[model samples]
Target chain A: MQQRTILSTIEGHAAADPARVFCRFQTGAGTEAIGYADLLRRAEGFAGAFAAAGIGRQDTVIVILQHRPELLYGFFGAMRLGAVPAFMPFPSPKQDHALFWSSHRKLLALTGIRFILTYRAIAAGIDEHFTGLDVRVLYVEDILEGLAAGTVPPAPPAPAIAPEDVAFLQHSSGTTGLKKGVMLSHAAVLRQIDRYAGVLGFGPGDVVVSWLPLYHDMGLISCLMMTAVTGAELVCMDAFEWVRRPTMLLDAIEQHRGTFAYLPNFAFLHIARAARPGQRWDLGSLRALVNCSEPCKPQSFDAFLAAFGDCGIGRGTLQVCYAMAENVFAVSQTTPGQPVASLDLDVEALESEARIVPAAPGRDSRQVLSCGRPLPGAEVRILDGAGGDAAPDLAGQIAIRTDCLFTGYNHLPELTAEKLVDGWYRTGDLGFLHAGELYVLGRQDDLMIVYGRNYYAHNIEEVVTACDGIAPGRVVAFAVESRQMGTREAVVLLEPDGTREAAELRRAVKARVFDVLGLTLQHVEVVPRNSLVKSTAGKISRDQNRRRYMEERAGNG
Target chain B: MADEESFREVAQAIGETLMVDPATITRATTADDVNGWDSVTHSMLVMEIERRLGIQLPMDKVFDLADVGELVDLVAAARSAG
Candidate 1:
């Protein structure tokens, strides 16, 4: 069978299982189900509506909706009509009105998006924030109504498009600065899905559940697109609802017999802590729990397994994967049903010589799990500072040339040129190839340089997390430009339990970090637990933390 | 007197729970008034408030409370209504 675009796959499914449930959404109002046929019809209506609204081939349409089925319809419908859809995160409650307005304006300006499809609730919110953005807003309900009324005209002729034509624009996490639109073609997305699905052995029998926002690559491609292609049922929830009642997510999985799920490390921790005792549900149907999008700590894995072990989750079911938006969704996923393992290396040797050395007993070691080998058709290489490939077992910047690689960053040729060198995408992550497997250490931008030594913020965080009173994996370590030293110094921000005194927590963090990295911590800020900034996908926002720190210092001064 | 004591107790509890100095606790204080208040901390605050007061505060109110005064007022209203 020849491969097809995501839209064709959905249309085929609709033809085969017109009455079968494709997507389900449960809200306070009630539960709603959209069958395959209904989904296809709605998507066709959306495409017709877009055509009526003067949105044609190559035009960009912004989609801002919660985890409703309408998001999928709008996305596929726009893309099927050869229009590029840019998924933007709904405004966070923490964002001030001014900030939200400015962000919305900036996104509009960047994407040149004139047509926006969003829920009525969000449209009102945005209107209240900014008066005249000159963008045409269409309520989701109106589009659905038009579809129901059969007012939408017949589909226009399909635009001429190649396999490499840009399908949709995925924005980066915007942790570093302004978000960049990652240009992914239809073929690239399908290739990525095939790689992941092939590796995990996912099929029609699988049911994938996710609460990650649609704006994120992991959420869109892994949960929605992959499920559609594999004919797997999808269960999705809003992020806020998940955070508020995490047990509800588990209930959905058990109730729906969901077999596959993925969450970032922090969410794993949150769910483990939030799940109340004696609230029993049968999770025996769950076959895979892939943790990715951030570093998967052993502690989080253990906690989740222990919490759900009575309900049939086992050790081998916990797999860790590595992924980013640039390479589509996943680069490497631990083979399903494999026992998780880590490579324990001497911290000093790994940092100084860029080699993984076995740790002696009762000594400090950096344990980074092997993300497994690259997916088939994907080539992984570790490049030195000069872009030459590093030798095996040597750490350097990780790069990959894959059929699944994105086209480039949308409209940023210079930045795209810098990252995509001779068909190899520089991932900006420092890692090594050991015995043909990839082990990611940390991002090059997040590396802290202090006193002629290189220390990764994540490594420092791991050290501090070993302390009992401090919340594990909640530490944010960064390098602040020190005026006295004329270089960057390490500043560790920890969210400690209320019982720990500031001085004690600071001392403990400094001692542990220094002991592990052989470098003194310049500053330690002990804030309330859960104070760290995180991207929508729940990865720690280091640049945001640095900006907040600078803003605080400026305010204090 | 009872209301004031209850208010003070809630304020102190929030201060201690959030690791803010008790001296910094005030009726007009809010999450934004504090140095390191973010959404995660805000969630913690909501959880702590519920635990300390034995009240199930609405999620909207938990997110909408801009100051200590608003929190106290909401708590008081809930208490009186109950």
Candidate 2:
């Protein structure tokens, strides 16, 4: 499909149906909505205000704000003026604002953001982070005020946009710490929107209900951008609000007759657990409830069906998508209305035999959920550790080659070169292909998934080593498989510097990590100074430490 | 709790779930007062209390309980009504 600009699509839909509701969102007041015509007006008003603020066509603006209508107006308006919008999440509750500010400073210095769009209160909170930056702040309230006051330059000339022009920068890590902007061109995003949306059978008639954070790729591209491009109705809520009121999501879906939504695995469990007795929602209106951004748990599907099946949710409604910011949005998604195919793998075969064999009904079966086939124009392959193609049913590193692939990392060329080989991007994910469907296992790298958030082992180690009693450069953090939670649990094993009590050391380490990263440690083992093993080069080995810990636990059992 | 005496028992269970010091937790303790008391843990805490007390606090009214005292009263009310 030949596509040039994102605005053209939005404009086309607006021209066709000016009165059609484009999106709906919750505010402190209550539920509010904007029609296509109103959206075009607000977006244009934002672009005009941006132009009045002297924002140039090729500028990069970091759009950080709470989940609100201004998020769209600012983002789309920036794009309208041919400025690239890089979305970052707001300073969420419980988040370490100082760390966020420091990292964002590093990122802004690297990317050279020309402008920032955010609230005054949010700006004040992180004002020190951008203390001396040349970047100008574009407050949301100021823009709205300008529009209201009729001071914004009306009808700012829309810049000539090219398909090859950078559309936006996206970060892969959902929960946020390190910021690596994956630069995507308009062509790539357009291709992704067409192909991914087509396969999912998204049309103007379908309404989207989501509480996924706007900074997240799954929420940004799959839900907001796609729905906007298609002129489909969207019912939205902020991530912070959703965390407090998850059932409100179902309430919106039932109230709006929402046909589609997507969430991570942990959310499925959250919703199921949050359900009150006798509370019912019309979930049957949903044609597909895509599980993505994290490993899709087969058991969560069972739990969801058991909890909400009475609401008319079908077996096929729960689907899985293997996606990343590097690929614009989705590499693959299960066919809508088809039960996500799963395999009960033999655990012994998974290790000893190195083959994925069908599990026997007895003791050692691992139920693995299939993430499904590649989207049109996308190619997925399993590569063994040696870089050669892996045999079917053999788990290996997942890689993708697609037209929608990002150009490269924003400022880290070496990092981009490390992951993108030839044309195929090494996903750092491990999975196997079976029956033309992909079953994602976990990350091949030491990236740990805890409570559905990605945290690198190296980063965790950095935090652990900085603790009071922990020895520097003698820390190892890894994830142990947590069968009960349907995801891995992060565990840390570090050498104490002195004769401090182990329990105290553990508590201090855990508290420091929690304070810095909000990561709750499942296990914090303070081993003897030299108990942890090292490589021949004397570098601490996380894999070896993890193995030893597991063995000790097994022996105790 | 309506009995007021059951407040300590309820407070202890909530504190255990959130890994917070129960003594620090008062009738005005909100979810934000404790670390790790976000959505995931909050739901777990609510479910745990429901299971332990054999009372069903209205999920819709969950946000109404600003602290341990209000939560106790709500739980106790639900129990007595049931």
List ranges where model 1 is wrong by over 4 Å. A1-3, A93-111, A119-136, A148-150, A175-177, A446-557, B1-23, B48-55, B72-82
lDDT of 1 by residue, A352-408 (tens): 888767889987897777787788888888988778887676799999889888888
Task: Score chain B of each candidate by TM-score.
Answer: 0.79, 0.81
Which pairs of residues collide in model 2? B1-B72
DockQ of each: 0.12, 0.23
Position A298, candidate 2: lDDT: 80
Residue lDDT tens for model 2, A1-557: 43458888888888898788988877756878898888788889999988888887878888888877899889888888989888876765445566755666666777677688988765556676778887688889888888899988875677788898888888655224466788999889889989988999898999999998777788888888889887798888877567666688899999999999998887887788778888899887899999988778888888888999889887888999988989998998899988888888999998775688998878498888888888989889899889989987688998899999998988789999999998999999988888888888778787887766678888888878777876778889898875545566778888888857776677677656765666667677778878899988898888788898889978975
Q: Please name the candidate that would achieve the greatest lDDT relative to the true structure.
A: 2
**Docking category for candidate 2?**
incorrect
